[model samples]
Target: MKAFTTLRTTAAPLIDGGKLMANVDTDMIIPKQFLKTTERVGLSEGLFHELKTLADGSPNPDFVLNKPAYKSAGVLIAGDNFGCGSSREHAPWALLDQGITCVIAPSFADIFYNNCGNNGILALTLPQEACDVLAGQAGGGNSVFEIDLERQLVIGPDGAEHHFDYDEGRKEKLLKGLDNIGLSLQQDSAISSFEAQRKLATPWLEKA
Candidate 1:
């Protein structure tokens, strides 16, 4: 996982679901057909496949991600309940591969929200009105958004700051770039000591 301190980049808005445009599930983020592999490197090609691809397998001109302005967007401004449905880690992997390090939404599914933190993506929750404001700015295609993870603030294109709250532990992990494995490694000395003691107490079991 990469450390996430601050980011200043373009945002891609995915707010066209319908009504409240909520529940943009994991399957929608990366379709089932693209879930065949466990590797994360090439998942970007499959990110939002159904929505970004045309019936003829060409890139959909209408899709926000396919648009030239948002093609390299590093932030994603989404609708409510983003990352719902099945708890697939691949969703965040796909987003990371696509160069999106931050996602701003009104709300998010619990599992997906944690997955984002684990994978170094900032899954930010803000008021629905705030999300709408950011989305409007993102739609302009030229506006830049700044996310300060340390400050817990999202500075909009017009220089307005939207404050957000986040879990302290998760926030710290993201800032330190500590994934589960990295966290485990932090206890390496203690683990080694425990293993050495166990070997002494159960030499016969170790041989078996």
Candidate 2:
């Protein structure tokens, strides 16, 4: 897991992810064609692929991500129920590959939210009103936004801040860069002790 504390980045409005478009699934995020390979490389090119390019593979100048200002965007401001389809964790992987470290939305799909936590992406939920404001401001020249995990606040490019809440367990794991395995490893001594006791109790089952 990547340690998360404070991050400041240029934001890109996730205009078509699941809102403007009809149900953006994991395939849309990474596309089915790109799913065969397990390697993380080349995943960035798949992020918003359908919208970013044409059938002939030329760039769509009108898309938010295709624009110069948003090319390096690390934060995405999206609409409600973002990541609504498919439980594949590939969606977050694609976003991370493209340098999107934070996603601000009114809501998110359950599995996608957990996947993001496992993979070190910040999924921040704000009211629809707040999302609207952030989306509108994100395309401007500065497009900068700051996310502070410790303070649980999102600082807008204009310097105004909005507070957010997250589960305490997840928060601790993120702050410490712990994924599921890492979390379990934190109780290594306990697990080892339990295993030792179990082996002793079932001695007959042990292999020579």
Q: Find the candidate with the highest lDDT and give its number.
A: 1
lDDT (CA) for every model shown? Answer: 0.91, 0.84
How do the residues 1-208 of candidate 1 rate in per-residue lDDT, one tens digit apiece? 8999999999988856532367899999998888899998999999999889999999999888899999899999888889999999999999999999999999999999989999999999999999888888885588999999999999999999999999999898999999989989999999999999999998988978
The TM-score obtained by model 2 is 0.92
Give the top-scoring candidate (TM-score).
1
The collision pairs in model 2 are none
Write candidate 2's Cα lDDT for 1-208 as tens digits: 7899999888888675434332456666777787777777678888878888988899998788888888788898877777877787778988998888898888888999999999999898999888878887875547678999989999998899999999999999889999999999999999999999989999877875
Listed per model in order, the count of residue pairs whose N, CA or C atoms clash below 3 Å is: 0, 0
| Candidate 2 wrongly placed segments (more than 4 Å) | 16-23
TM values, all candidates: 0.95, 0.92
